[model samples]
Target: MFKAIADPTRRQILGILRGGRRTVGEIADNFEMSRPAVSKHLRLLRSAGLVVTRKDGTASLCDLNAKPLRTIQDWLQDYEAFWSDTLHSLKKHMEEGQ
Candidate 1:
């Protein structure tokens, strides 16, 4: 999941999906890259479980699967708490020194 989202292009594709479901062509239209390149990014996202794609007739519609993102957010919350505590300790130490 981390590897899939590490690329800026993939992140952008995810962002597009956040608005709502979009066809592969609609997604490709947003970028300067070839349709195949966009399809490649979509494939990575699908593998990461970040995207859900379905066939709507001839068009492939992609939607965001945000469940995986909750895991990332939960992991980051630990670091957020750590930083908050560290900053609080630093402030206390600086005040004590003064």
Candidate 2:
């Protein structure tokens, strides 16, 4: 899943989908790339379980599936406090020097 989001284009797509569901055409319009290229990114996102696609009549709507992101977030939580403490220590040291 991380591999899927490693691309700048794919990450941009996720940012757009975060706003709301969008049709393939709507997504393609936001990018300078061709429709097929956008579709390729969508395919990767779907494969990674990052987005879900549904057919509404003739249009395919893509929606963000943020469950995977939550998992990633949970995994990163352990580092948050460590970085916060490190930053605080650096600030204190700088203040002492001043």
Clashes of 1: 0
C-alpha RMSD values across all candidates: 0.9, 2.0
- Writing each residue's lDDT as its tens digit, candidate 2 over 1-93 gives 889888999999999999999999999999999999999999999999999999999999999998998888887887998899999999999
Best by lDDT: 1
Residue pairs in candidate 1 whose N, alpha carbon or C atoms collide under 3 angstroms: none
Estimate the TM-score of every prediction: 0.95, 0.82
- For candidate 1, the lDDT comes to 0.97
Where does candidate 2 have its weakest 10-residue lDDT segment? 69-78
Error of 1 at 90 (Å): 1.0
Model 1, 1-98: lDDT tens digits are 99999999999999999899999999999999999999999999999999999998999999999999999999999999999999999999999999
What lDDT is reached at residue 6 by model 1?
98
